[model samples]
Target: MSGIVEVAAAVMLRANGTEFLLAQRPVGKVYAGYWEFPGGKVEPGESVRQALIRELQEELGITVTECSPWLTRQFTYPHATVRLNFWRATAWTGEIGITAPLEHSAVEWQACGTAATVAPILPANDPILKALALPTTMAITMAESEGVERQLERLEQALQQGLRLIQVRDKGWPPARRLAFAEAVTRLAQAHGALVVINDDAEIARQAGADGLHLSSGQLAACTSRPDFTWVGASCHSAEEIARAGELGLDYALLGPVLPTPSHPESSGLGWPEFGRRLNSNRLPVFALGGMKNELLTAAQNHGAHGIALMRGW
Candidate 1:
């Protein structure tokens, strides 16, 4: 078997705030009626970007202008291997309404994560979408909670065990406790070669000498400028919030409740498939959160997720 045959795909997301244009495939076709990103095969000798511009014209009658370079990934199937190259094209000419390209039947611009969303979505694309819906991991640390002294102990454990980065969240402490935990954790994570962001407290982050800050979706709208730091992340559920956070120049995000969690059994959850659909081409890097198990990491990574955030999946 020849590895992956070269092909290209376009994630033509309209910067229109709330909705992304999703197309449903027609019946009587391979992966027919499946919902998918809206570009097609690359012709021989054409560059991926060129193929994108041409495919958009053919499929949706749109002209591409500017695109962000992102590698969602390559997946193999039994029938054929697809080396899918994708880009987040922001600058475009015509609107993304379909122009009757062959093999497609219906299209709609839906909120990426609404519960009402359903699918004829292809399975390979699911992982990318799922990853897009996750938010960056923001870990909470205690100042000697449960007789744990060094706040860095857990952090160090996480990092040494392959955790690349995280935010340090601390609450219920005096100024001294807060500062001490922040300062010590900051130094500890840095010494262990990890990036540390502070949770919802920009001032404390700045004072404690952290790498950056993290905010909830509610706080995202209030941010005028990104903090002067190396990293910034946010929490989001809806596509609107995710876009808002992205527009505010957040470095990444955590978006979830993708699956029902033992922690929160009351509210409805976005099952894995629909979660992937909404998150497929999110502007900012997203880490899967809520109900993330260690076993799900491979699934999340395959779906275009940057990583996973967890409360108990250590």
Candidate 2:
């Protein structure tokens, strides 16, 4: 392959942030007829942000006002190796008119996290879509600290307040008890249109009909291939572990103690600066995991995290 081609892609969310636009490649271009996020090639001397702004203006006819770097994916096509830099375009000015008729044949906004309504999407974009579907806050179960009944009550309140991503990780319970709890959590989560991932137990996740699995760092290191789950994630403490999660094709990762927490009082934390440094230009979405709360959402996102994950105070 020659020098890698850098392309900037947008996950342009509507005002509600629940839907994003996808465009069809116009005829005569490579991958013509395939659907993809709207973007174009980065030119020499242009940063990814500069390319993104230019591409959106040229293709969608809108001026980007707010966008955040999310993920970077590198794929080798038969002809060339391409690196796709993805940004979440949260806000823009002007209506998106089809000004670049030569670039896109059609454009439509679709709900995030749902199965794609558009057919024959670009092969390199599958994980991008999955990442977009992840919620901004991942709520972990605190059943041990809060009694099971109290926890269930809290889960209901959290779900009602729009907590869409969850993890069930009460590992001290007996196998039968854990399975039962997983089943109950799944049922409640599904009812609220939330997703539940069981920690470190693919069998329990499967049997409980949970949406995914969350691998411990040990489990992640032991894995040779991606687990068969719709939304597999792993706990990553170091940059090496984060890279391993990406190699294993996990949909997302939880990285930190960005701050010192009661759970590990003696352990020093990554802090915001180090957390940002570690996650910069990472290929997959990562959630800031220790000592996180809803108020830190912006802080986490500012540091290149997809969102924040919390055991308490979500």
Candidate 3:
């Protein structure tokens, strides 16, 4: 077998970040006519970021001004094995299509949180498309500390403010109370077109009609199979845990204590550098958990987080 090919793929987004660019492979390329994210093979000795900057400029005529490591996926094709390093590009210079030579036959912007309008997307990119649809903020319920009624009121307010993803986490509560709370959260979230996942309780998740399940670290380690849900995620505090989550085919993982939190005051958090290092080249989207607030989203993204998962800040 030949050596694996390293490629840098860009998820170039519009200013609002609700859309990303996709290009139709030009004739004569392997997958010609099929659509894929705009990018190219990484040359020897070139870092993925460097390749991303060069590829976007060459293929789309835009100089990428901002980008971050997102996910890495490997695929084996008839022709070769490829390791695709995906980056999220949010800012750039030069107008697409008009500013530079068009390397592909065509290009179009795809809206996030929706099915692709373009046909025949490259097979390796199907999972990436799904990951892109996940919202950047995850609210973990704190009904254990706050009263159930108060938490429900806050959840409704948050939904009104455009919160689209939530985790119903009240492990301290009795099973009956937890189930009732999860049911109420699911109902409110559904009304706002949001998704609700029950923490560490598959029965409650199903019983409450939650959209998915969120596993605690202990539950994640004990699982032998992916749970049956539309979306499944886990809490991960280490690289090994994150890898396990990916191996289990989870939709996402929450990794951190990126900053010190009141809940874990005795332990110092993994600062941004360590968090970035642990997250490098991860296959699935990961949310930075613990001490995260609305304003920390950009900082978290810069350190390779898909988004931030909050308990109190949300």
**TM values, all candidates:** 0.56, 0.93, 0.98
Candidate 2 residues lying further than 4 Å off, grouped into runs, are 98-103, 264-268
Q: In angstroms, what RMSD does candidate 1 have relative to the true structure?
A: 16.2
> What lDDT tens digits, residue by residue, belong to model 1 across residues 1-314?
67667666665555642355667777775677788877777788898778888887877777888664344456677777887666656567875564434445876766643432757577766644643333334454544453336546666787777564666665567666677778887887778666777777878889999987888676787788877776788888876777776677677777788777776988567766766666654656777777787788656655656567775555
- lDDT for 146 (candidate 1): 37
Better of 1 and 2 by TM-score: 2
Q: Which ten residues in a row have the lowest lDDT in candidate 3?
A: 259-268
- Quick one: RMSD of model 2? 2.0
Ranking, lDDT, top scorer first: 3, 2, 1
Name the lDDT value of residue 258 in candidate 3: 85
Which residue segments of model 1 deviate by more than 4 Å? Answer: 1-151
- Between 1 and 3, whose lDDT is larger? 3
Prediction-by-prediction clash tally:
16, 0, 0
Number of clashing residue pairs, candidate 3 = 0
CA lDDT of every candidate: 0.67, 0.89, 0.93
Question: Could you give candidate 3's per-residue lDDT for residues 58-153 as a string of tens digits?
Answer: 998999999999999999999999999999999999988789889999999999979999989999998899998899999998888889889999
**lDDT for each residue of candidate 2 in 1-314, tens digit (9 for 90 to 100):** 68999999998988787999999998988888999999989999999889999999988788898887889899888888999999888888877774443358888788988899998899999888888789989999978778889889889898999999999999998878899999999999999999999999899999999999999999999999999998899999888899999988889999988987888978779999999888866888999988887998877886789999999885
Ranking of all candidate structures by their TM-score, best first? 3, 2, 1
